[model samples]
Target: METVTTRTVEYPADGLTMVGHLALPAGTGRRPAVLIGPEGTGLNDFQRRRADALAELGYVALAFDLHGGRWFTDPQEMLERCLPLIADPERLRGIGHAALEVLRAQPRTDPGRIAAIGYGTGGAVVLELGRAAADLKAIGTVNALTTGRPGEAANIRCPVWAGVGSEDPIMSAAQRDAFTAELQDAGVDWRLTVYGGARHAFHHPPVDQSVVPGVAHHPRHARRAWHDVLALLAECLPVAAG
Candidate 1:
């Protein structure tokens, strides 16, 4: 097994030096990598654990901080924090590219086989990358692909897999149908897995959702969602564009 190494990196974005962690799998060969987009709140325990899990699978994983600061003052404050960036897909795409560049530049990472996975806003970030960042191989998005990207939609050349809870309040039924339709029009190979009886943020087990509405957690779906992330990465990044 490769020894895991974690280090802090300063990413220039959004008007500040955003902090991120680089989890590298031991040994020097070029390894597949994934840039993890943080949830609406920011980088949290769940994101870090996911990074560690990816490293254990022999991939260089970067858990990036899209939101300002290390932590949030409150969840409602999330509106003020992420609304601007989220509303504008272009900024989100720039953040994704910056993070991708950071990860791809790492000595241990395989730049040619890079992919991205993000939760909440982060999920949207990765999905947009799949559409806008032609260089990205695969995209894993969970419960965060809300808005539509018009021109960017038709350009995503890589495989896309989205995870959504059947009961997720954030994702409307119409939105799902439209998303699928867009993928078809673009000729992008994509899959949508809707977890029955699950809610939003299903992958974050220990999250405290006191402030969040209709966003509950289901362990079964979370487990399956995490497992599928690995399988998707393996399939897409391995044959991804170099």
Candidate 2:
């Protein structure tokens, strides 16, 4: 395996100190960057490993934080925190913008060419960031077919690709329809893919304990979603030669 550099960073967000993992590809020059968001439980090893994997593919990646660097193994705790955050778009935007600033400030990142991808609640945060009119090359989200404030999606300037499990109760048919409708109304380029026979949190690996009902891992679908996100990034945020 090619060596990649990794670091832990602390930043402020939503009146809390957030900690994230930053990964840089093994190279000598600046590269395209990606900001990663985690599920409702907050940033964990899974997201950090994703940043490391993206770095290996030549992109500077930062796995942004949520919940002030805490990971909730309890479903109730996760829900208590995430539900309110999701309902408040401004709070989500604050967290997303804080992470974006951290990613852009990295010496190895090509600030002008950056993308955002997130899972679950984190996915919603990226959408909120897009709605806030943040400049980004692309936005890819999984299991987060969330609708933002009315007419706010028009602020999104980049192509968006979202994925969800067909059986995901959290991202139901109505939610998907609303999400697509918002994008269409906003004139934003977007795509949605539903993985059959999967459930909510299908992109995640098996956990030691279940954090949410109806959330189960599907290895095949997880792999497919990762490839799809990578394809979205390649299409919209290709790394330039240094």
Candidate 3:
């Protein structure tokens, strides 16, 4: 494994002080970067570890925060905070842009070669960035097949990949259809993977904290989803070989 250095960074976003975890690879020189968005519950250990893992793979990664560095354990509290944010594209774009700026300002980041990946509400924010026509090499999301305003997806310049559980009630078949339709009509390259028998947040590890109904972790699917996201990065925003 490569030597990875990590740190906590604070930035302003959504009228709050956002704290993010940044992970850097061992080698010198600018490297392709990735912005990681956490679930609606906020930036927790799981997401920080994800940034570290990406750094180990030789990419500059920043796991950006939502909820202003606060992690909500209660499902209702999380929904109350995230639901409206998700519904508002401009707010989501503001959060994504703020995090992107922080990631780009890093000394080790190759700003021109960047990708955005997020989970749940965080994933929705990543999509909003695409809709806003941010300079992203690729976009990937898990359990967040959110549909943006009509004609906004035409601004997306890179391919998009999304993963969802087949049994997720929150993201139903109709919702998935709508999301895909928008992407297709916008002429964007897109792919969707449905993990059979899984529920919402299947990529997340099982937690002791309270969660909404139908939210469960599937270890096998989680590993597969990670592999898929890595493949997407390798193809779209690969770090240059030393």
Candidate 4:
């Protein structure tokens, strides 16, 4: 069977019934899977498509919802709800670990071999997993990461990748430079790929946001980011024989 199935998974955490979509490859035998963190907007279509794509590749994929299905395009309100999680770095780590746990419950999933991929704000959450020391094989982050917190990149024992655009407004050269320096100082086995001229959320194939005159687009970088993700995932989550 080529089809993957999904359901609203309710987990007990943080005083809410956190809902998520779990996608598993049909007729699989212990496939390696991952916990895919959604972009700034909760469990949006982009993430669901990505999870489905992973299933087509014969891997189980679960896209976790940190926002509990609530979202806003207004930058201010978005900041309001999302700010606190990042504010307390320790709490963010807990949330990351919690999402990983849900990924482990898939029947066809190989708990021993799983990774994480986070986008935008979700990228920061995945980064915190390193601080909390989640037992993950690998981790990938796509743009919008912070480096100010203490022990942000310390003792990360997994193969990690940080992908961002050179022209991204949020992750400026100076900020990303500092983030990379911390990663190196912590002795992490990681790869930092910077796309020449892509904006903050360039990975999404179709975005209808009003361009703010300054940020530019680079489809080449967007494509390369996807390739890099697959390459990293292959390196992180190995396939097994039936």
**Superposed model 2: Cα runs more than 4 Å off:** 209-211, 240-242
* Tens digit per residue, CA lDDT, model 4, 103-212: 88777888888888898777778878875677778889888566746664675779789898877877888988888888888888878898876787788764545633
Q: Write one digit per residue (lDDT tens) for candidate 2, span 1-242.
A: 55899999999999899999999999778999999999998998989999999998899999999999899988888899999999999999999999999999999888989999999999999999999999999999999989988889999999999999999988998999999999999999999999998999999998854646788999999999999999998889877543
Indicate the TM-score of model 4: 0.91
Flag regions of model 3 displaced more than 4 Å: 209-211
Q: Lowest summed-lDDT stretch of 10 residues in model 3? A: 206-215
Candidate 1 vs candidate 4, lDDT winner: 1
Reference-based TM-score, model 1: 0.93
lDDT agreement of model 3 with the native: 0.94
Measured on C-alpha atoms, candidate 4 has an lDDT of: 0.76
Clashing residue pairs in candidate 3 are none
**Considering every candidate listed, which one attains the maximal lDDT?**
3
lDDT per residue (tens digit) for residues 1-242 in model 3: 44999999999999999999999999788999999999998999999999999999989999999989899888889889999999899999999999999999999998899999999999999999999999999999999999999899999999999999999999999999999999999999999999999999889987753446888899999999999999999999877642
Better of 1 and 2 by lDDT: 2
CA shift of 239, model 3, Å = 1.3
RMSD of 2: 1.4
Q: Each prediction's Cα lDDT score?
A: 0.81, 0.93, 0.94, 0.76
Superior by TM-score: candidate 2 or candidate 4? 2
